[model samples]
Target: MEANYVSKTAKSMQLHRRAKQVLPAGVSYFIRYFKPYPFYVDWAKGSKIRDVDGNVYTDYWMGHYTHILGHSPSRIVKAVKEQIEHGTHYGVCHELEIALAEQVVKMVPSAEMVRFSNSGTEAAMYATRLARSYTGKNKIVKFEGGWHGGYDALHLAVKPPFELLESNGITDGALRDTIVAPFNNLQETKKRINDKEIAAVIVEPVIGAGGCIPAEKEFLKGLRELCHEKDAVLIFDEIITGFRLAPGGGQQYYGVIPDITILGKILGGGFPIGGVTGRRDIMERMDPLLYERPKFSFQGGTFTANPATLTAGLEMLRNLEDGRVINNLNRHGRRVYRGLEAVFERKKVDAVVNCVGSLFQVHFTREKVRDVNAAYRADKEKLAKYHSALMDNSVFFLPAKNGAISSAHSEEDLEKLILETERFVGESGY
Candidate 1:
């Protein structure tokens, strides 16, 4: 048998065939591989997804850390459905927009005002512009593994193994204007500073895609102090962490506030939305009335602040009133983390896990994945084997180590993940 996933889904094969002929890389995203081909998803619901072949799985990818309250949550879905009935897009202001903005201000301690966009990239693109415009400076400093939504500057040296400096256009001067220091390297980050030319230091607080590594409290606090001392803005790109870590996201958890925060993912409850919000004075520039003309910031998209997204966002924000989502997520996350950790430890396997709040990553190294260097040092080959086996055993991850958590998952899901992982490690000869 060539795996149930491959043997079934005849229509999927045809669809992929047609898709590859027209679509770049056979899909819009690089992760949607068509070489070995990819499985098609029919639809999904709370805690479970059914692929084209009806392989029901307790999905943990959660739309790449986007679905905090779970897939098509009733509150979110109801909001969307009602809004959908009212002609999807309104290229103008709406009440939902105001509600969403107000909700963000109330929840995120750092955000006094929020301007919406359709994606985190846009939020980050504008955050960069705002940092430059506010400070009258041009340089942007980012951590080694911090991914701030894939514009030219922040995308550099993103996923390369720690030992290698693999990047493009991030030259010495490029890097000089855009400082790239190893995460958690307080001295290196300190050395990159001087007489206030660095416009901002942008980070994820807990770097999500970079193997779920959380900054040491000292490292984050140091960045805060250094940015303040250097007259630079400290920006937290909480696109993934916002509403996922806690009601206030990483800012509340870490207790180190940033000057500006870029948000996405959970804010829209799995819809395509993003926002950049901060101090009122800085955000007022986006107000057309202030300048007698509407000017575009990096976060501005034509679809930004439209009715449908605002509805979904407003509902999602409202759902956080109970604080139960974060609590459930953290509980499930801890269970999974501990279950996996115990398996590795009891078996004395050469593996490690990085966990914080409700997010985690299982690295196949005993060295501890504190930073990108250690994450790169982990046994990726074993991880691949483990990932494949877990899939075979009917659990779902991102098919990559860096993934998310959700309130929808249960301990049963964790057991499935752990048992499959242990079985793979013991049997796969790693």
Candidate 2:
């Protein structure tokens, strides 16, 4: 498999060698790196990405699942092009920013106010600080498998061996107040959260980086009650599930509202952006006019609300506001989930498919993958091989990463995915 991939991606191999000389890990993000090097994309359109080697693959990765309407959708491209002519980055406020914020407030169930940032990590960091400021409590409760970016405060125990640090530089003081709780298991989570003065309970409605596992509706409801009982804020990290799940995001999809929503990915409309939004009272903690020093939770940057990002994001939201596009994606998600599961079962492959809305992942394990531990226990090596096989067959899914369905994906694209999986299963003797 490695040799076959290498033969097809000669140009990418050359670029990887060049990239390794400058960029750490030969990539901007470590997660983008894969065995035998990764392909360098020349361009992408609709649901296909063409590598520099001219190999066109049906893309399920979809720019880290950011392109809900598909790569360079005409609407966003047109809006961004016009906005770029005016100004790309304005180190000041603009109507586009206000428009985007208002759109967020109108769409998100709990968003009465919004603040933009550059990425999900920054949004998570800001949300943590704002939670601490609002409640005057230092402790935070996060699920065991929840991945809220690389923020130090909530970064621990994202994978298996849940007691270890996720990275090297994180200090004891940084994670001292962060508590790890079990996902999907409310009783265990409560035991973990017992008597702690939690400022916020942060969770991803559908776990992304940890696995494509979704929180049970009852579990989310339980967390909502728990947070309210403790007078702690309930934060939903809807970065992956934002507009992809519904116009109002996971909060609206699950019918359980949260105090804060951390958004990114599709919210940027394929541009670089992140956002924090919530009820007026909780969100106002970041307002300098409403709160004095020591109380204000600061959140600003040189590109906090860049005009270009806002323009693309605003246009994206306007298209999704009617719910037609989102509902179609959700329908596609269900079809893919059922189709993949049926294919695996027919092949007698002991695999589990985890899915929520437009996101899905295949675990090479017979056991149920309800949480991160189960996901980690799966045959990761086999899963990687399967993904590589799919890629070699011109269906791209980042190895061991969740696959996302976009509006651009057609019935044929989905059929090809299922067929490829079936082929991999039969050939691999799994």
Identify the leading candidate in terms of TM-score: 2
* Cα lDDT of model 1 by residue, 78-108, tens digit: 8789889997997876788888888999999
lDDT of each: 0.78, 0.92
Cα deviation at 369, candidate 1, in Å, is 0.9
TM-score of each: 0.93, 0.99
Name the lDDT of candidate 2: 0.92
| Top-lDDT structure, candidate number | 2
Residue range with the least summed lDDT across 10 consecutive positions in model 2: 88-97
N/CA/C clash count, model 2:
0
- Residue 133 of model 2 has an lDDT of 96
Which regions of candidate 1 fall more than 4 Å away from where they truly are?
A: 1-4, 161-176, 194-196, 288-299
lDDT by residue (tens digit), candidate 2, 33-74: 998798999899999999999999999999999999889998
